[model samples]
Target: MIILGAVLLIAGFFLGITLLTTAGFVVLIIGAVLMLMGRSGRSVGGRRHYY
Candidate 1:
């Protein structure tokens, strides 16, 4: 997810789309948070408890 967000962010920057860049940044933050929470053994909701 972070990788995808980074890619989108780069693309947005090149395309000069301010909104896309902002959205990409938001996605990147969300992905990082999710990754950290998963590593900490916290479930994002569901019983699987796996990324």
Candidate 2:
């Protein structure tokens, strides 16, 4: 998710697409939150890992 977000962000920026940039930022934030929760031994969506 993070990687995808980054790619989208870069692509959006280069292509001048506002929607993709916004979506990418949101996705990146969500992925980071999930990863942090997993590392803290928390379950996300009933799974130990979000991946």
Candidate 3:
């Protein structure tokens, strides 16, 4: 999700697509939160690992 977000963000920036940029930012934030939750020993969506 992080990687995907980054790709979308860069693509959006270069392509001047506001929608993609917004989506990428949202996805990146969500992915980071999930990763943090996983690291803190919490089960994210019943999964031990997010990746």
Candidate 4:
């Protein structure tokens, strides 16, 4: 998810696509939140731990 978001962000910026850039930013933030939660030892989706 994070990698995908990064790819979209870079591609969007390079291609000058405003929509894609906005979507990428949103996805990136989601990924970051998930990552933070996981690192804090919280369960993701109530199933698996990130570590």
CA lDDT of every candidate: 0.83, 0.92, 0.93, 0.84
lDDT digits (tens) for residues 1-51 of candidate 2: 888889989999999999999999998998999999998999999999888
Residue 27 lDDT in candidate 2: 88
Pairs of residues clashing in candidate 4: none
Per residue, candidate 3 scores C-alpha lDDT tens digits across 7-51 of 999999999999999999999999999999999999999999898
lDDT string for model 4 (1-51, tens) is 777789899999999999999888888888888888988888899845542
Estimate TM-scores for all models: 0.83, 0.92, 0.96, 0.85
Q: Which scores greater on TM-score, model 1 or model 2?
A: 2
lDDT score for residue 9 of model 2? 91
Which window of ten consecutive residues has the lowest lDDT sum in model 2? 1-10
> What root-mean-square deviation over C-alphas does model 1 reach?
1.7
Each model's Cα RMSD: 1.7, 0.7, 0.5, 1.7
Better by lDDT, candidate 4 or 1? 4
**What lDDT does candidate 3 reach at residue 23?**
94
lDDT of 4 at 18: 91
State residue 45's C-alpha deviation in candidate 1, in Å. Answer: 2.5
